[model samples]
Target chain A: MFDAEKFIDQQVKKVRDEVEGRAIIAASGGVDSTVCAAIVSRAIGDRLLAVYVDTGFMRKGETANVDKMLGRLGVNHMVVDASDEYFDALKGVTDPERKRKVIGEKFIRVFEREAKKFDAGYLVQGTIAPDWIESGGGLRDTIKSHHNVGGLPADMHLKLVEPLRDLYKDEVRKVARALKIEVAEKQPFPGPALAIRVMGEPTRESVAIVREACAVTEDEIEKAAAAGEMKLPWQYFAVLLPVRSVGVQGDIRAYGFTIAVRAVDSVDAMSAVYSKIPHDVLERISTRITNTMKEKVNRVVYDITDKPPATIEWE
Target chain B: MVIDNGGQWTHREWRVLRDLGAESEIVPNTTPLENIKADGLVLSGGSPRVGLNAEAMGKCGEYIDKSGVPVIGICAGHQFMAAHLGGKAGPSKVPEFGKTLVSIDDEDDLFKGLPPTIVAWESHNDEVTELPPDFVPLAHSDNCAIQAMKHKTKPLYGLQFHPEVEHTDNGYEMFQAFIDVCQAHKKE
Candidate 1:
C-alpha cells in the first residue's frame, strides 16, 4: 500500500509551491540534507542556494567531502568558513542546550547571511518528523532539542521551509534513493554536528579529539560490516566525556578523557536499539582512538544504553 | 557535594567544583538526606517547578537544618532555602535572564575580597521577595532584591545569580568564598 513514487511526486509538488521564489537549503553532505537539496533544486532550479557552514566541529575532511558531494549533485552551493565564528560563540559555554542553541543560531545566521548575498527569502532545512516530535511542542515533554528544530531562535528572520518534515529517517533514505543521491545509505549525523558529541565546552581542541575518534569508530565499524561480521548501523559516532580518568598507557600512567563509542540501529530516530558491534570491531576502535590520540585520550568505552533510558547523543 | 536537580547547571557546577580542586559528585534529587556525606553541599539551580515528588527539597532542608555544614544554594536552591525557612518566593516582577550586577550590602565572609558591586549571570523566573527571621540579606540588584542571603547563625548561604557561569564577574571569587566556608567549617 506504500506508493513510493506517488508520495515523492506529491511531496515534491507540495514543496515546490511552499518554496516559491529564491531559497537556500542546508546541505550537510548527509543523505537527508543532500536529498532535500536535490529535491529543492528540481523544484526551484537556480533559485535554491545550498549553503554549508563549516562549524569546525565536523569530522575529518567533512568540509571537502560535502563540497565534492554537493558538486556531484550539481546543486548550486556555497561553503562558508564559519569555524572561527562557531568557536568564538561556543567559548566557555558548556551547557548542552546552550551549545545546541548557539550552534543552531549560528547555522541560521550563516545561512541567513548567505541568503542575503543571494537575495533568497526562504531557508530550507532537512528536518524530519522525529526532530520536532522528540523536540516536544505543545503537550510534549522535551526529550532533547534538535539543533534544526527546537534550537532555532524565536526571532529568526528567514521564512521557514521543511519539505521532509513529516518523513522519518528511513523514509528520507527512500527519497534519497529515488533521487539517486549517492549518500542515500549514509548514516545519520546530528545537525548540531560534533558540538553535541563533546560533553563539556566544545572548544577546537576537544572537537579535534572527538573528530579523530569518530573517524576511527566509523572506519572500524565499516570494516567489520564489509567483512560480513555485522550489519551496518543506522547511526554511529564517538562522544568525548569532559572528565579525565586515570589509565595506563604502555606501562606509563596516562591521565586523559574517556571516549565513548555509540552505535544504534533504528527505523525512526524516535526510538533506537544499541548495535551489537562485535568484540573485535570494538577492540579495534578502542585501540585506534587511544593509539591515535594517546596524549589527549587514553581510555575508550562503548555505550550500550538504549533510547528510552539514554539518548543517542551523550550530551 | 553537587546537588543534581536534573538541570544543565548541576553538571556544570560539578565540573567547576572539580576544577577548583574539590572532589565532587552529582547525586540525584531523590537521594535521601541521611545518605549524603560531603565536606559541603551545593544547592544547584534547576527546574524545581517540576513535581517535588523527588523529595530533593525536603532532604536539602533537613540537611541544612541538621548537618551544620556549609551550604551554598544557587537560583532555585536560593528560592528553596527561602521557602524552607518560612520566606516567600513569588514570581519576579522582571525576571533576570542573562547578565546583571549585584551590589553587596555589607562586608561579610561571603564577599570577603570582592568589590562592592559584581556582575553575575542570572536565569530564574522565581525569586525570594522576603527573608526568614534569622536570614541576612548580603546583596541586592535592581530586579532581584535578595541577590544574596546567609543564615544569621549557620554556615548556610544562597545566591540568586549563577557564579558557575563565565559571564558572572568575580564568579570564581564567590566560589572561593563558599570553599573557604567549607574549609573554615572543617577546621572548626
Candidate 2:
C-alpha cells in the first residue's frame, strides 16, 4: 500500500535536514506551495521565510487570498509589490519559452534580493515531480519549461531546496490535508501565473483581461458545482488567445480577443481529460467573461480537446 | 523596458532590467509605443530583424525626438536607431551569431563598471555599417565593427551584441550602467 502519511513524514524529515539554516520559499498560495510552506515551517520553524512576489500576473484577488492563507498557516511571510517590475519585464515578449525563462529569471532575481534582505542562504520552491519531468533535460522531449524548473538561469546564486519536488498534485494535496492546511482542497495554479495563460506578449492590459475572465470562469463553475449542476474539475481557468475576432455586443460590431475557458480532470499534470462541464454552466462562464471584460474580450470559447490531442494551456 | 525581437535573450534583458530595480514591461513589436510609459527605453534583440513598420520602431523614433527619454538600442534596435537617425543599416559582410569578443574604444557611460574586450551574445544578420553623423562608435567586434554606438550628445545608445544573455559576462553591469544613465537623466 502507498502510505501517504509515511511518505510525508519521511519527506518532512529529509527537508528539515536538507534546509539546515534560514530559507526563503516562493509561496504562491496554491495547494502545492502552501503545503510545502506548511511542511517546511513545521520542520524549520521561524527559520523559514515565505516570500510572495505580486507579479501582476496573478489571478483576480489572488494576492489578497494568498495573504489571508499565509496568515492562516501561521507562516512568516512577506509580500513584495513587484507588479510594475513584472509588467515591465514581460513587455514585448511573445514566445512561451522566452516568457517562462524571463519570469523564471525574474523570480530568482527577486527572491535573491529578498533573500539578501532576509539574509537567507537557501531558496525553497514548491516544485513537483512533473515540473522537472516536463521541463525535459535528458532523453525527455522538451515539453514546456515550468518557470520554477527549466526556466532557471545557469548562474543562479542561491542554493535550491524543493520539498514537494517528488510529489504529484494529488500527493501534495494529501500532505496539505494531513497538515491541516486550509488550501488543501484548492485548485492547482502554475508558478508562472497568468503570464503563460496570456498568449503572445503578456502586457498588463492583456493580463487584466485574462484575470477577470479566469475569475468569472472559476466563480461560475464553482457555483454550478456547489448547486449540484456538475462535479467540479480538478483545474479550470481562462486562456486569452493572441488573435482577435469579430463579434456583436448589444447589436454593435466589436472586435476583441477571444477567451478560452478550460476545465480538466487529472491525477497528475502529465495528462488530463477535458471536463464535461454542463452546457448551462459553460453558458454562465461565457456570458460572465464577455459581460465583465466586454471591451477587451468579446468572444468566449470552450476547449473540448482532451490532453492527448491538446494541452490545457493553448500556448 | 526592453522589447523582445523574438530572439532568445529578450527575456534575459527583461530580467536584467527588473534586477536593476527599474520597473519594466515587454510589449510586442506590434504594440503601439505611445501606450508604454517608462523613464527610459531599451530595445531588446531578436530574430526577423525589426521591420520599419514595427510599432516599436516608430515609437522609439518618437520617444527620441519628442519624449526626450534616454534610450538604449540592442542589436535590431541599434539597426533601427541608425536607420531612424538617417544612417544606413543592412546585411553585414559576415553574419555574427553566438559568443564573440568585443573591444571598447573609449570610456563611456554605457560601458561603465565593465571590463574591456568582453564577450557578448551576438545573433544577427544585419549590422549598422554606417552611423548618422550625430552618433559615434563606442565598441566593436572584429566581424561587425560597430558593435556599440551612441549619439554624440543625445541620451541615445546602441549595442549589436545582447548584453541581456549570459554569454556576455558583464552584461548585467552594462544594464546597470544604462539604468544609471536613465537615473541621471531623470535628475537632470
TM-score of each: 0.63, 0.62
Q: Where does the lowest 10-residue lDDT sum fall in candidate 1 chain B?
A: B48-57
**Local accuracy of candidate 1 as per-residue lDDT tens digits, A1-315:** 234576678867977878767999987898878888888888789998899888888889889998988998999998988889999999999988888888888888888888998998999898886677567653235667888998788888899888777666777787877778899998888888898999988888888888999989999889889999999998999999987999998899989999999998766664456898989889999988898899999888888876544667777
Evaluate all candidate structures by whole-model CA lDDT and list the values in order: 0.80, 0.80
Runs of candidate 1 exceeding 4 Å displacement: B1-188
> Candidate 2: how many backbone clashes?
12
Per-residue lDDT of candidate 2, residues A128-244 (tens digit): 877875676532335678889988889988999887775667777778777888888998888888998988888888888888888889999899999999998989999999889
Q: Each candidate's DockQ score against the native complex?
A: 0.01, 0.01
How far residue A141's Cα lies from its native spot in candidate 2, in Å, is 1.3
Worst 10 residues of 1 chain A by lDDT: A133-142
